[model samples]
Target: MRHVLTALCLVLLTSAPPASAQDFPSIGSQYVDFGASMAAVGQMNNVMGAAVRNRRSDRVDSPRAAATTRYRPSPTVSARVRTQFADFIARADPAHSEGLRKFVQQNDLLGAWEQHVAGDGLRRGDVADAMTAYWVQNWQIANKVAFASRAQVQSVRAQVAGALAGSPGFARLGDAARQELAETFMLNFIAQGSAFSDAAARRDAGATRRLSDAAAARFRKDMNLDLRALRLTEAGLIG
Candidate 1:
């Protein structure tokens, strides 16, 4: 399963960009590439020694030590992930897509159609029209697929946790170490799954917000670490 996920990530990262201009224009192309790269990096970290290191470091005794040990994605990667999220939502929901188009048109978000044409040979109106069409075409399919994919990920996590608990190797570990190991594995699992699941959640604004809130809550429940603090440490963002 891990190898499958690793291969999936690799494919996503190296796959050619969508050839159809109608599917993804200049800015959208940038976003998909960035998001895929971020996902690949996450997959690599989870597959390599990072997960092991996190497990070993989970034995910290002091609050400060725990605080310093939380994993954080790079700031630039986080920004790109967020942008991809917005783009995904815009493409998957008709109402959201229309709202975005209206907002862009009202605010002149891309400057002018002529300016976009001059810069990238893409007209602002075309981008808006494309988003609308994409949303209409994908709304139902995207939502259904996203829901199923998220459920499958959760099921896999449960299976992994159960297997680990019953393993002889896990039984040999000291109580503290066993707990740490389980937590580390679960955290890594969530982190890896987030790369794909969160992208799926972007099919709906409510789902996206819920995913964010759930992540913050999970960090607190699983690690006794504040998600906001971790974000601050990673991105230097206040509040």
Candidate 2:
């Protein structure tokens, strides 16, 4: 009953007219929106890491400690990531990038990431909940492109992986590390998207709950070691 109510609420919220249609456009036609969003996410993750490092440096300024910072992307990579963010903002919401970047810089994304990483099995629930919320919020666009072909899905995955590989401090890692993190993110994202589409198409709240749970569990079990190895958090994974 709770699941049914939750699904009904999601439907009601998503069915309403969007505040601005220009924000979505036809970007989903070729998964352009998703690619751009992934780029933005990667950029933001790097920004978050930099912000955290700066704050820590203010309190404890040891050259050796600073030298060991794990997640600061190079300035060149950061610039490239910003361009990708610009592309996304240009297509989705022209006025969004600056404000979003500012918010991320000031936000406690590092703390959020830390909390998520320390949650053990509870971390999966975070991804599952976030995936559900994301799909529900973008139901109009996501539903339209829900049945993407295998080739299309793979293309999008590759683009997103490439984008992430260059940001979020992944640029400092080896090729193998980049590939593993990218694969982990894509697996969870693709599975969540498919599961939501299936549940929505069938109008099955139970299925939605079950599939989301399963996807979350799989993501947690499969990516746990890789995420730790890469020093990435659930916040980064969800992004």
Candidate 3:
């Protein structure tokens, strides 16, 4: 009964009615391809290790240490991650690149759209959620393209290629495996999107709990996005 009522009060940007107080984790940190997010992930894992062992790195200075010691990972980690994620992306996807270029253009329009619909904040948020997913697709496709031109991605690709070049474990896959992985990601994304659309349709929280399953499904799909590896390469527009 409480669940039904809470669902009605939900902001509806990919959240279900709160089944419990457990926050239906919004795709916030996971969705956006912030640059330092990955490094932050590493840093926090390091910090956590430091705390457990009571050891600190030269890099883990000041408040992060204090905050980590105090058991406040969210605020410290979130700030650090956001900064790092942005920086990494700038390097990964350079200026005028198609994926980076497209994302910048879209984020500008999105920001403008949000301002106009500022009063309808919840509705704007929902649209933002959808847009973020779209950006993820943009990043994946562009990153794959960008990777082709990248020494690092190429190195990884070559290693994978060499590893399986003569191996009996799916050895015949060769480069076809890369194409297959791409296709699989696209297919999975389509299925995930369809589920989210259905979830969003019956978004209201009734006793039936309609679309909760879809929401959970969509959440899982976005969660698997390798967020730490995500790169947001916005050019002049979204500095």
Candidate 4:
């Protein structure tokens, strides 16, 4: 599936001149930023979990010490976030990397963590505050980038529609569903994927499970159709 999308992007690139600076953060930008933000959330969760465990241990000297204890981020977790971000950038537009770095810097993520979050261990309350700030800032960034690339997404959607015109999966969609899909396919893709990330950050296992089940459901109540067939079609299991 990634190959197909990348192939489409490559074709688009060859068929036209480079997108203007106004299109700086294209769909690729939203994806890379979202991926990096998700990686940060996962790593911060590890840091917070460790801090919670430490707070419960008998290592503190006194009540005062325990109350003042802060969460020292694990070096391993920090490095892992950087590695994952590097991987994300490898698949993103080169121009988007600069903007991503600036966003991370503004939010004190990655290399800027010590500067904005805390040079020393962050207090338990401070950690929570940092996490909330990170999530909120990243959400704003994702929305801005997604909205900015609307024209590009619509162009790509048209190309995809033309390419899959005779495909059985598309044929199965009702007129309303097809219209909705054409208008908001990429946006829905980002929204649904972001919901899973939000679930993980909130540690809502039940929510994650529900999302997974819905994605795989053979029938959709709202769509009022055999969505399983559409899923198979999207996965290239059918025309």
How many steric overlaps are in each model, in order? 0, 0, 8, 0
lDDT of 3 by residue, 48-130 (tens): 22232332122221221111001112334333423433343344444423333233222322232223223322112221122
Give candidate 1's TM-score: 0.23
Q: Over 4 Å off in model 2, which ranges? A: 1-91, 108-111, 121-239
Model 2 C-alpha lDDT per residue in residues 144-207, reported as the tens digit of each score:
2223222322232222333333343544654333333332232223223433444555577666
Candidate 1 vs candidate 3, TM-score winner: 1
Please rank every candidate by TM-score, starting with the best. Answer: 4, 2, 1, 3
TM-score-better candidate, 2 vs 3: 2
Best by TM-score: 4
Scanning candidate 4 in windows of ten residues, the lowest lDDT window is 230-239
Residue 201 accuracy (lDDT) in model 2: 58
Candidate 1's residue-wise lDDT over 189-229, tens digit each?
22223333333423545544444454454434433434344
TM-score of each candidate structure, all chains considered together:
0.23, 0.25, 0.22, 0.26
lDDT of 4 by residue, 68-159 (tens): 11234444544444444444443454665565444322332222222222321221222333332232222222222112122322222222
Give Cα distance to truth, residue 137, candidate 1, Å.
31
Local distance difference test, each candidate: 0.29, 0.31, 0.28, 0.31
